[model samples]
Target chain A: MSYHLNHLKELESESIFIMREVAAQFERPVLMFSGGKDSILMVHLARKAFYPANIPFPLLHVDTGHNFPETIEYRDKLVEETGARLIVGSVQEAIDSGAIVEEKGYNASRNYLQTHVLLEELEKGKFDAALGGARRDEEKARAKERFFSHRDEFGQWDPKNQRPELWNLFNGKKNYGEHFRIFPISNWTELDVWMYLAMEGVELPSLYFAHERPVFAREGTLLADCEYIHKRPEEEAAVETRMVRCRTIGDMTCTGVWESEAKTIEDIIKEVSIARKTERGGRTDDKRSETAMEDRKKQGYF
Target chain B: MDNYDNMELLRFTTAGSVDDGKSTLIGRLLYDSKSIFEDQYDAVRESSERRGEEGVNLALLTDGLKAEREQGITIDVAYRYFSTPKRKFIIADTPGHIQYTRNMVTGASTANVALILIDARRGVLEQTRRHAFIASLLQIPHLVVCINKMDLVDYSEETYEKIKQDFEEFSYKLNVNDVHFIPISALKGDNVVTKSENTPWYDGSTLLYYLENVHIGSDHNFIDCRFPVQYVVRPNSDDYHDYRGYAGRIAGGIFKKGDDVMLLPSGFTSKIKKIDTFDGEVDEAYPPMSVTLLLEDDLDLSRGDMIVRENNQPEVEQDLEIMVCWFADRPLQPRGKYAVLHTTKEVRCIVKEIRYKLDINTLHRNEEDKTIGMNDIARVVIRTTKPLYYDAYRKNRITGSVIFVDEGTNETVGAGMII
Candidate 1:
């Protein structure tokens, strides 16, 4: 009777409208899944968008071959439950095929190599549009992104030369070889995502909840003590069990955990409401430089 | 958490150059409202120190692109979000330059309010007129004129009055409906988040308070029922074999169950059987809510079709008079063929005639000059391949606007408002 939608419902409707637009506009579209909360939210919205019909497209996961065991398990279960087709783009295959070289150092990460594999897989699948869950509030560079972002044949983003998007009309037209990176949740913030997840009573990975894990202190951050991460002698000696949870999910070598006791969704919501740091503050991939995300985005890194 | 279900979303656009302290005002809003995280503040502080700035430069918080940071100017529209207990705000921060009119138009398309910043000492520059003119042309419901830099003018009542008078005199020719004025200093944080005592003569609320408490419930058109079908949902499974629903976001008016509706392009009349959403069925659906409508009788309907009230129907016309803002480098060729995207329909249109171009600064119509180039506003006539159901822009924004995409290049070239 109010005739007015709240902030969360408004955001949800906007995102659903965008996803339906993509389905109607593009010929061969795919959703990019990373087993993160944002991507999980995207899958849920997509399911609600076409209600009785199966999701009109498959989900593309660019696996870095170094992920938390729980993430892979969650991804498989979600795919099966949603009845969605899954397509994996493997970074390990690209590294073995000599398409990309893995970094060699104490802080080696396959995060940068995933872009190559993703582009190659897109080319293989002949997908014209790939939907992503990247939000504008995540990084400074992403703040300037449009809902329908165009990419050249080389899979590069030209930040300066973007189409002018007006109102709800989105122009998804492109050339033969070119494609677009569509973001349905470009307007939602980190806290909005958490609140929506909690409101819907959605299931998330156990990594998001606090649990005892072996972590080591590196650069004032608690990195999970795993074989994927190459640590120094002192770091190895400093490994200890701590109660921590992941604010975000990404490559195991790059994502850091926050020490916390918040276990339930309500506890996480309360924590996020009073948290003083941005969600990406714990992401090691973004700390390299001020324009690190911009540089990576230009090279077609989602 | 209790207020989460009742909070509203307000989107507004701000237009100003770097000197008007636009970035500083935004930073102050986020900081004072406890929206800016500590890490973001620390990053801005470090960047300021690296640039050898005297103090923490608030402008560094915005200007996201690498080139923008290096050149100290915003090239494109950047969106920023913040929320209070009562409302969540989205700021479409745009640059106020003569060449960036396209960017400003893009940002102003969806904004409920347009914030125009004017330097108190400068007193209504050309940029201010251009911004106000665009906001009015875009038909933004409300306008907030903030006379910035009150501290530089010593917070004098005379200065504020003079500037307010000047803006009012110029705004008389504009079509803006609701206008509010406030005096603030973005640098010293006076009358921005909290009211300032320096301006004891001023009786208006602060900028944040005005934004939070603005009346926007009546902004939507709720009298005419209009639903542009975007997609057709058909779940052909064993659980539900004979289900057909028209999915779309309501463009105008209110639609209730068992109401008589007519579909466009195929004039089939039917009664609404039910209104369905992901959560459950609703008794009625309103504007901006995406839902599926099930009719009592099965009718031939697809995308680009519209469901409207039987008594109130939009004008079906093949020829349209539109006021267009060109956004591409290539000049709009007379008698050119382009792709036109209306509510949920795509059709081909040819440029029939170029009536006249408007000078935004002087508010004069140039009938002699007919060349419409990038960042130019002109009146045009176009004929579509198929008739479109539309209303005047002033009547309903959602059902009356369109975009022209170049057929060859596939780029969005111009934005048009039905006249």
Candidate 2:
């Protein structure tokens, strides 16, 4: 073996390489961390990108304000750990500042609200590059994504008009005010990230594993019982301790959880290996329609 | 199943014609191996209802694009991820039609193996030869030819043996070493996940078993260490004002601290002092690692500068002989020059020679035909303005492969495997 459990090291080297390119090619680059496994992997990669040196760039979080407390706690601890600047583009703050208005009725999610806040953050920071943890295998639209995905000033992606990313030579060159959404892990699959985490011994939020929590059934999904999510009056709210964990974390309203008892990375790997459900299945935002992810992606929703 | 300690990824591309049972085979693998999620199965059932399909549409899980659903054709590459108990897999669900060979090449570039699907009723078709040749040209080491729809032929051992013999004789001209043939009915779920009881004549591991047990650990080029610097890590903060790290992914081989390395094109030598990530300084760095490397000797290195073993240097030349898969809707004109990108290095190139265009099927080289269209494979020489550090495609895939980008349209016109 070249190195014991070197998958993470290899993955880490690739991410660091991408991160360094972002800093050199763009005037201002922001790491769009959402406190998820992929983004967590992104942050961990950034640490290696500039080891013996702090993360040169700032971390940008487009907070929907409907996130789990544990994820936020994990995010804060990570930010504190690296000493990198944290820029929060808060949806709640945006609503308070009259920059964006919250939805009123049932089926409302701040997940969509994240777009406006994210665009505003890019405009405010004048960031030329924004790194995301988007993987191609996760979604169909993402499968058509480029490594240096170009975004218009309005933050729109015209899937039809994408540049050819040949070999490893990425074209990071862009006009001023035009930002790029770089996905270093664009080639990485969901299982690869989980395996890398296990190999690297990277810690994540407890919400990832199977745990007992208050949940309610909505549209054939197990949604965490939270106040921000609009629930119908007739819907029954029951607090049952069940083994469940989230495949993807989003605004508490939009993200769903599956009944799983995978507590460790090994257990999760086994569970993932056997899982036929797409990770986005638990994501309520994606369950809206067949092309929900595509529509959102086109509208600059990450 | 016991030893996964040296697990390495095996990405492969699948190419076949429509109704070749590509989707069915993949679905069978997923279903038998139980990779499908409960909700995914539920959605498949619901979609099947909407489509009025008699059985669950396994294609619904993989064919995620809407146009593909509406048109019943695959236009772009669809990537599917599945892991067995032993190895992880990234299956590039490329289109079978000739029009989408560009997508196939993109998928095949990183693949270690290629699964060529053929209908048992239509053995040794033109498209089958085309894909197999493409796989061989791309230097994919393993080839698993699945003779699907065996039930149509009544699972006759004679039919299987005849087809295998014919295929072997036809493919003898190509340099494919690790080749295996299997008979299965993808629709009936035979020999895909579990061993088929009907196939008493065939005594081989099931498709899933083969996929899981394949020896892929040695697929990577571990002899030559090459790292292309992507960005210079400079945390110009007061806490560490002097920290400078060269960040990049290792293109091939291994790297460790105190190892003497040289930067490419410039030939600047430096000793690797440390390899580290934000987590901490690591002991070593190797192929595919995304790490920041600190060098002891101060050197003028930037993005695109390759850090390689000072001793084992690759061929540095301006003229390149390559086998390329033409991928543009516009026909490749004679002597047309474009931007050639290999690894991180980019250089303007001139098409030196068109050479002979080979018919993918029949193994016939048509020297008379002067035109090279979409999905056509041909041998050609290219002259570059600057020197590139590369190896033969047979040696190192990462450092050997290059792509021709149309300068005006900025489209990747072709993917070339260096000779």
Candidate 3:
């Protein structure tokens, strides 16, 4: 018998170990669910971490109110099927209560505004730990993120003064009123996530597969033509139905759609293996500036 | 895609300063392997051109943070991932400056291999010695020394041989088991992903080929059966009212059904009734695999308890001699009390004595001055409040290591390996 575990199995075990650590270490931990593939994978691992018992934590979703219709439907179905409690923190509620103001421009998105709502929800819930689905391979700033990332009382991140993490021993000790943003899938790559999902036969939203959607070109990216996005004068003429799929699931206003004919999980696996662009290449939120993700992360964006 | 299930994962660490072409070597690996997406490459190229560089500066690829990009130095460890058809690789890129010894140790803690880059123009520098010392101290299973910048020396075979010999002589004092030497030019992409004909005297495999085919299957400990319980799973539902499972990631050895195991700190013995995973029941489990074990008898157990084979029990002692690496700005005080975390157990420990500090650069023991400051490695004696079940760090990396947490600030200030 070969004692070697394949890359996917190794990754799975690592993630499960991290989840169990969080469950044992923190008092009130919450799994931050975004209805994306990474968050879906996190829920699956959480179930595996403590098999005999239900997921000991609630799933918090900071609803942007600009989500794809299919995403919300899938999120509700998954919450019911897994028997996990769902906590929604609405961005619209935060906006209506004068907690945050909506941005006004042709390219305005609620992506940045979700940070305020999330922090507020976490504070209200008194959650000691928030498990996110951020991967190191997704962006530049995330590459230096620790598995147990610490946040100050104000929910800000100080990248330069992070505690050194050694081996499998993670130091989750923090001061009062301060919390941690735990990333169990920090070591997984985009390809590894896809492979695991395929191997487990996990289901995803319909937006991930190819379909005819009305989209318009904005800065060479195909943005879904929806009521949430305030298109420019020139972009209005470019709206047309095309076969497309979403590489990443964000707010409908910011997530880019790829023009492709591949519709099945197998097709996606083959496409991602040889793809030239990164999954984040189509994310308009990262295109705001070279240091956009870094700045937002420092401000406590998931 | 067909071989995805059979692919293995190998993690390696690289240490170098700004001028050692560490960034260029990493960039070459990712680029040649087609792991760098077009958008990422375009961003790097644009940033390079804006700074008036002649061509795309590969050094900008690994520098992620804003301050690092501005100061032109890596302040912390950044992880990078790439893969060939045969294996997946994770690179823990760290700075080689003497001040960043803490970061280097953190990266080396989990690496299977260490890649030490030696500039060919400067045979073996003090920085190279420091990197080798840390890798050896961390007990990395393999080491690959790449003599970079062969193009600068006109691909001289004699120059490469002298550096290799000097490094070997110095490494003899360390505890490294496997070491390989390679000649390459990271800037010009020679012997990185593919073999270059510039050095006809060299007959070794390329850097990528060596990384892909390195023997790392035996790196884990399979002789001592040890499992540190992390959490206990109990469901009080009607269908399974009395189910109690001990959950943890196996630290070492192989545990099978019907194996007689002893619980640590309690010394109670029981037989393994079953091994459970998310998928289903399994007959046996090995190191690094997280699984739940059900004992034949309901024994009183909780977190911080270790389950090991009866015959291979670890040493349980309150007094420990450890090799300490200080990581905090505040110097380690004599007889200072802090929280020590080993495996799943946390206990308060006091520094009993400061055995001499080891000078990492010279590999000398300084017995006169015993002040342990930041980035200093020393041999110290500590006494914990409770006895800890552990092995020598060289025997089991997972079960033998510990971290000291500052009680006041709640920051991890030190890491120690059991001696």
Candidate 4:
């Protein structure tokens, strides 16, 4: 008596199918967990993908060390709950080791430096596939990404020379050292993510909800006043107590918090539906250049 | 009640030449459906103004890559997602040039509908026929012939009818099940999201209405039982001991507990003890469902194994006759060895012979043109190292399709549909 699946159900099933393919194809696969809503959703889907059994893959967190405290706590709790292995690739360690130099400025972030650390981690772990929460609708460059995006031995993404992914069949075959960056939720938009979150009742970091946090204004975006961010003196940004929430979570210096009264998932969905800009519109890292994402992706940033 | 209780999904691909307004039509669909957010619209507007276009170019919304925007053409396939209250749609927007035939095939392979745009003044062009033929080759369930630029033809019913008739006659060679025609100007927002007052004589559902209402439930094969085991789920933990579930997405037919099933390549028979989903164990499972199956007997099953009904089984042969759409730039070499990927099974294969190359324009077979180049469709015979379990593509799409991979480059060189 069953008919067609609803949109959310269809998306879930599609994601589950992809997750299973990753498990079945690659020998060493890892879920890229950012402790954001998108990555949280990825963990949820991966868990469901191998239900009645623990996820065969480990959760790799490319930790920038500029994370919100709540996100780290939630990430640890999630790992404990799922019993999935956690591997942290630290950007701070990369900076400390002088492998990647830390940028120094008001808009300085560990975002770009994450590629070197991530690639080093991937090589060390010998992971053949890294499942990400990247959605195409988030950025223009991402829209051109394939579900089974191949990365060379150097962990570089060739936007022009990607394999044509036809149908549900994703070609995960690659050379010995070359690997694939799998995006199961590449088709999901920000609003769809919210709708799915509300529908599934998935747990997320508390930073996503509205709270009175000390924030400073920088380039029309609200930046959380944290130790990781070094504000320039000329930049007239004073710490203010405003009801704010994060649309996306990343490095504390790059991820922006927006003024909002919407605290719950339903409220977030409503706000997202009527929101004028994309979720990345609030991100300062993408504002560095039009092809910022493309450039970083070329260097293997997940 | 869940918000997505009754929501469904629709996957469609758009095809047209450079100036046939394919990008504009997709833009209009997204724009009129309220899927276009302000920042995205503003970005496109900014780019349009920077390019010195007088009016805001809607096509800029889809030309995402910098090279595409610079050349003003879609170079590769880009997937777009948007939704209405009734349905969610995934649009596989592909380039229209003959050089990009591989892109069209890649996009159309998974789509339920093929939205082929035809310029009203130009009628059914060669690109239209090529797109329709590819849709047929891919077995896309629905073919939507959007007669775009109707405003250029004054929205004349006679013009629409003439083109529709020409398309129908041309489509006679195609194997698509549902054929629909709509005349409208995607640039003008007519009969796309709303009924056009200009086309009062035409009594049909709008493009959006048709997309939201198209029946896609029966598109998958449910009569033939075929399940390819993708992975074996084993939890060596203490809580649940000795739990072995075969994990895979059901390719065809339906399975219930206690149903008699047989494993391919091994001939091991087992009864379905339980159909497990993420939610819980379900009573029955059908095609395209990713689930775990707990069998009554503990059988040694691994990846590349197929599960089927006791009575019905797919063809197990080492040699296969298939129609291949070559994707690589290098021409196919006779007796060339390749890595064949079919239904989670990877096997070494060699080209046995080239039957004939298909002339996409004339629908004729040229037996002399044995050297198939990139984007060329030809009947090819292949011999695999091991016997592959599959059904004819016409009967079951999931088991029938296969792709040839270049072992050195690991690139998918050709897509094959078994006869």
Candidate 5:
């Protein structure tokens, strides 16, 4: 048991080291908080990185507007508790500002629109480093992402061209306009996230566990109740109270939920343990053939 | 009773040249281990159909780049994760192309194991040995020489034995301690996930089994405590204002709360008052744990400084002997100096000497030749502007490893393992 705890401790240390490198190497580094489990774990890890000191960097959220209310509430509360600054880059603002055109007709999620706002915010804030909680195992394109990903002034990521990160020493020098995207928790999988949560006793939003909610089925997945999202003509759902929880949350227009009775953290661990599907499987946006995440990532999507 | 259930995380990297079936081996491991999902399999099948391949091209699962998909080779490090109900593994899938050698160095830096895939038809080729040499220079604890495509070689134990012997004879000069060879056909699923009937003479466990069983808990250095302060934690709060914790991940050994430790670069002594995590507090800390250590005495310490146990201290020096894996496209400058990074410390260092270059194909050391080109593995000496606290790479991979950066270009040119 001691050794087991030691191994977990090792993982935490490596992550913390990366977090510190971000702080030391970059200027105005900010953490991308999605209110998802991965991002939540990242926030938790960032706390350990600079304990006794408030997370030196602020937490940034590229709001898609279409979000589970629980995610927004959790984000505010976590930031408040940690005493870290919170910066919001709203996709709806981008749409309203006419910087990005909202999707038309059915399946019009602001997931893609978040890129414009996020890129603009980074430019305006002069953030030299942005920490994200993206895991490589989540998608094929993400699998090839660098831990300290370099982005051009235009906020474009060239998978072909990246600086090699050798050892614990990270190279963070860049042009005035260029910035780095750091993924301190890049090696973790969904299961590892759950286990760490259990071990750390980290808090989470209620949306993470099973609960009754209004929903509709689309693209072979359940969609949570939201105003902006238009209901498909053929879909029908009863207002039944069923145990359910979200594995991932993005645009209220596209994120889905799975039926489960995993109310407690222990129950959720067991449920996720036997769960065969990946967390991304709950997202309808990624299900759009292959390379959706890749295309968006290239364009600087959070 | 089950050791596998114990927590042990292994970070290994896999690098391969064109047509090395690196993706196949990865897919094979995931598929046979039941890590593959039904939807993922379906997507791969559909993509295979879209690509007009006769069967599922498991490589499609990882070569996510359009250029790589078109060229049928990996161009970047694709990190893959899996667990065998024993040790969880994080694999840095690096490309073996000459231009991608930098990626390989990045991948191998954090790895405890290096799984080198060798085409059975081509025994001990240039790329194969180059990978092995890099693994050795990086001081990877275990090397799994997976002689893949055994089906191409008729599953003959004689062929397996010959390749194994040739590899062993070549690796003798290298510093790799644990070397293993497993003949497996990643395509046919032979000895990758389950025991293979093709080679009954080979009674070894499956490749996955071997990876699962390899002793990696001891790979880390528990002999010396080295904590490189990454940041100074000063939470401006009434409950924790006096709590100026030296925050860093433990690079090696263990540090107890009451342990007397010396702060490096400043040579100040302090006692660890607490090791705090979000889960409240811990009694002690070890290598890789990112716990915040609070000291009873707030001595002069900052980022890039090291914390070590008083009785068990690492050697402090400016000049160090290192075995380096050259990753720059431009050949290493003979007299040029660059910035060297070890742990969180950065110092200026020059290539003091190039002893010899290893012939990757034959695994022979060519003392007469000295070319630190891309993917070149060589022994060299470096003189640093500042003294770094370090242990031998063989002794402590975390503290002994360093990376050189081209100050002008800001590109990481090489990775060195202290000898």
Candidate 6:
């Protein structure tokens, strides 16, 4: 019967609906694009939400300066293809202006500092709502996040005092200066995202598939040999060739790759289907503490 | 290979006492369906070992928040996603404690099915009736009373039938249209994903089986057309100019390409020229499908304006009678003004009167006490500054439900089902 929708189609409809709501409700809204799979999927859904007509909002990229060069290239290409405006809020700018302090040591990352740049961008753009691809299944703290997550004037998320989002009726009412971090795909798990991408034939960065990349092992996780990471003198991390791929894309200093031979989307789906570890298991940023994500989210990190 | 990508989506909410194995039931569902990853299972296993629990605690899987884990209680509603080969499920795992009863209302608001867990040993407690009442009040289409911990009750048919009879007696008072009873042991893995041989006398589909096969297609009202325009798309480009389309998710009924529609408040009439999606134009669009409608005539319409079939129109009124479940810490004061959010529309409203407060446990109406505190359900009469196009809760759920946001704090203070 035509009554039931396929899982992927259903999720697409849901995401499109949320994107439309954000466009309709907020005075000025922007989609947070990281050139990652989830963000790419969100941008793709936004296109579907308002076809023929351009996406009402621009894509805001909170650049960590530690992102892969390929990611930047990919981001520019997508924006060019869609004819959507791109606004870059650089962490380097924040660091240069002494607005945010840079972390030290080998494990130090620009992940946390990106929040400051993001907040600055929101203020600069006067955007009332920021659409993010943060999924509930990504982390424990994210599990409690609402589709329309209300942020205070300081852009801090109060997990304790979240507005009850029931049904498709999202309460977008907010005071001036206070904004919302709306997650259109909050209900989607990592697997659902991968499957949707595969079904929709949406392209992602080359880093997602397996390829020969020079990487080093640190804290029992594979870190890409990039200029962003600072290795201590005592710790020996030699560049070695390995078939690796990123489960979750982020700043090179914080994100880690996993050993995989999955080169195609179908292969990646199969690998993910039987994958034991959580997608963030390879993330060095989340390993900082028990509630690292929650702490950062409270400080306005998406 | 199973085509899970084509499975239909089902959103369900679970309600029960703190120790009634609500989390355990969800864990069982996720674990059995292979939704739980190996790392997640190991993490939970390690946590259980650290806590010195006897076995790998399934309940540990659902206790997602750090505060919940520290306190050993679910403090709020946590949305959990899992999928079977047949269907996809979104479980709104709400806390069962009395203080967090509003969480149950929040969770049940969008659910197609309300899953109420009953401890077999305890039979039907007041808590069970309370949850059932909330589910009925929320107008959740289906009710599945899962009699959990059957192993503790010796898996006896007599016990199952007794509990079923007691449940039926109480359910008679509920307005739930579809109700099913499944004797399950979330801990023992019986009558959950597979049919349990323990209850040979009670031949019924397993919980997962029933969830997959439940008749939810007809759950939505396909009779009355309701399309609350969320946004208007006008691309000022070289390729195509002078094009205006209304973008929104169809709240109810089927909208065809050549349908005559009327816009609210503006009293403008237009005929649908095309129902478009990103992929292409479609023959018809139904409830929950996000599509763009290009009307034959360009009417002055924006967000908050609704388009409906001229013949079947919803009640457009300013005075609303609603059964509100208060969510804020501050009690709702009579004549106090708050922001009322319905669909995509937001309007300022004042509490005109309090019809009565509903005691969830006893289902008693206390008209004497007028103060609507946190987790209290009361029939509130609200007078909005602007008219809200709506329908009765029984007729159309999407348009019927509304949430009140405090003007000062901006917190969603109350959830209401229009009576």
Best by DockQ: 3
Per residue, candidate 5 scores C-alpha lDDT tens digits across B67-123 of 888888899888888877777888888887877777777888788889998888887
Decreasing TM-score order of the candidates: 3, 1, 4, 6, 5, 2
- TM-score of candidate 2 on Cα atoms, chains taken together: 0.89
User: Per-candidate DockQ versus the true complex?
Assistant: 0.84, 0.44, 0.86, 0.70, 0.63, 0.70
List residue ranges in candidate 5 displaced over 4 A: A1-7, A236-243, B1-5, B310-312, B352-355, B362-371
lDDT of each: 0.91, 0.79, 0.93, 0.88, 0.81, 0.88
Model 4 lDDT per residue over A80-122, tens place: 9999999999998888888889888767788988888888889
lDDT of 6 by residue, B1-419 (tens): 26765678889999998789999999999899888888778878988999999998988777876788887888878889887777779999999998888889889988989999999999898778889999999889999999999999889888888989998887887798899999999998898998888888778899999999997887778889999988888888977698898889888888999999999988889899999888999989987788989999977998899999999999999999999999888999899999988887889999999999987666789999988898888998999999999999888889998989898887889988998
Between 1 and 6, whose DockQ is larger?
1
Residues B1-419, candidate 2: write the lDDT tens digits: 23333455567778888778787677677677776667777877898889888988777767766777776666667667666656667778777877766777777777778999988888877788778887887778899999999999999888888878888887888889999888998888889887888899899887777887777767777788888777777767787687777777777788888999888878888889988766677778666666778889878887767888879998899999988888788888788989877776678899988888988776678888958898888888899988888888889887898888788765678888899
Give DockQ: model 1: 0.84
Highest lDDT model number: 3
lDDT: worst 10-residue window of model 1 chain B = B16-25
TM-score of 4: 0.97
Candidate 6 chain A has its poorest 10 consecutive residues by lDDT at A231-240
Error of 5 at A219 (Å): 2.8
lDDT of 2 by residue, A19-69 (tens): 777776678889998988999988887776666677778999988878899
With candidate 2 superimposed using the best TM-score fit, by how many Å does residue B412's alpha carbon deviate from the native? 2.1
DockQ, prediction 2? 0.44
- In angstroms, the error of model 4 at A291 is 2.2
Between prediction 2 and prediction 3, which has the larger lDDT?
3
Of candidate 5 chain B, the 10-residue stretch with the lowest lDDT total is B1-10
User: A51-116 in candidate 5: lDDT tens per residue?
Assistant: 666788888899888788888998889988888899998888788888889888778778878788
**Each model's chain A TM-score:** 0.99, 0.94, 0.99, 0.98, 0.95, 0.98
lDDT tens digits by residue: candidate 4, B1-419: 24445767788999987789888888999999988888789878887888899878988887777778888888888878888887778899999988887889989988989999999989888888889999999999999999999999999999999999998898888787789999889999999999999999989989999999998888889899998888788878886688888888888898888899999899999999999877898888886778889999988898899999879999999999999999998998899999988997889999999999999888999998688999889999999999999999988888999999998888899999999
Expressed as tens digits, the lDDT of each residue in B111-195 for candidate 1 is: 9999999989898998888889889999999999999999999998999999899888899999998999999998888988998
Worst 10 residues of 4 chain B by lDDT: B1-10
